[model samples]
Target: MPALVRAGTAQQWPQALAVPGGVARLSLGPAAERPVVHAGDIPVLVLGDAIEWTAIVGIPLAAPVGEAEVTVQAAPTAPARRVAYRVAAKQYREQRLTVAPRTVDLAPEDLARHERERAHQQHVMATFSTPLPEGLQMRQPVPGRRSSSFGLRRVFNGQARNPHSGMDIAAATGTPVAAPLAGRVIDVGDYFFNGGTVWLDHGGGLLSMYCHLSRMDCQVGDVLRTGDAFCRVGATGRVTGPHLHWGVMLNRTMVDPALFLPA
Candidate 1:
């Protein structure tokens, strides 16, 4: 996908595009609001409640079938963002998505085997060799090194579980967590597994999540500036350490963080 909303004007709002590609880029003019779809004609889905200035959109692509008109709009978001997207689904059609969730608990030897398989999954995610979203700025939501690597085959004691969904950055208890980009804070909760959490809506189909927080600073519908504090890092939920489990949902699929960050 193209990046930075065309790179003109003073400010930009996040443009959402739901087409093919892991990262969708748009150049909405600085302070530009209600940007329209610019990708000529194609097939894409614009999610609601996600369009705003200076946002990141996570897109999921359906296997393209011949010709289709891609529609983009904003209304309600299941963390939706939409604008424009690049056309690449025509050539990349083999989507044998491997979903091995371990299915059950296992003995130590079996767990080791699972870990090996899980490592292979991570290799697959990194196999695409795609570049990061152009014009993206990598600012830490909270200062810390990585506590958990992406796609680590996590075993609780001796039982294997699903690979880690998001990247975990090590931080201290009560460390303030900020919005990495501008967006509306839409969801906040203390779920059974995520501990304290806050979901930020970047305009046009991109949504970000910060989990295992000690506190939530913004309520739903609260607009936040990039780097604005939304919560604090904590060891809540199911955790082996205190860290921020930061995740970006591009059209619902959880891609790698390195897909957006500088290499």
Candidate 2:
């Protein structure tokens, strides 16, 4: 697919919520589709009628079944599809669910300022050109059932918030966090939601993040081998317990980690 096209703000997604994964997909039959991720985000562009794309954001697993809005804007030439989704949160054997306390309070502007962060994330997608590291492999940083459902809506401490940005691996405090792949550390610090976070640049615009670390080992610019000790997982930012929150961004778009691993 081409990487650029006439971009426009899609006014809305009327039926975007009915899909199983809270995602809507559009498959362009047989034409090359151009995609632009705003800053450091990935833009999922489906090309060809047989290639429908899926758009999904996670909702809280504990949330009572409900409805939410999705914003979309595209043209007939670049038409968009809307899908509504039904959600049910499951707990026990494999996973658990609950509310996470906020690490801090955000004023309206402090929260809205993230649009720039989101846009910048998308823009990073346009510059992807690095190769993945050699001899790079990964083991689960923490061992536990998933907690925060990926792409789900979340209400932190009673205030509505953005969808969960990463996958939650519920482990005990100080669970060793390892590098999924070999890469140079580019960013390491506390984020608004990702407390004590670190970003690994596995070539190109591909990156992975480890958050809520109770103990951070490597610093920015450190080159690491796969499975290298990166940090110690914990519920540092806002949480009920110690767990490792792992996030991966491919060309800046957040894709399921399972896609890159054995299920």
Sequence-dependent TM-score of model 1: 0.54
Clash totals for all candidate models: 38, 51
Query: Which stretches in model 2 have alpha-carbon errors above 4 Å?
Result: 1-129, 133-138
lDDT of 1: 0.54
Model 1, 156-228: lDDT tens digits are 5456555565778998999998777777776677754566878776644455778889889789779888878
Show the lowest summed lDDT stretch of 10 residues, model 2.
1-10
Best candidate, lDDT-wise? 1
Highest TM-score: which candidate? 2
**Global Cα RMSD, each model:** 11.7, 10.1
TM-score: model 2 vs. ground truth: 0.56
**Candidate 1 regions with alpha-carbon error over 4 angstroms:** 1-136
If scored against the real structure, what TM-score would every candidate get?
0.54, 0.56
Q: What C-alpha lDDT, on a 0 to 100 scale, does residue 13 get in candidate 2? A: 22
Q: Any idea what lDDT model 2 has?
A: 0.53
Clashes of 2: 51
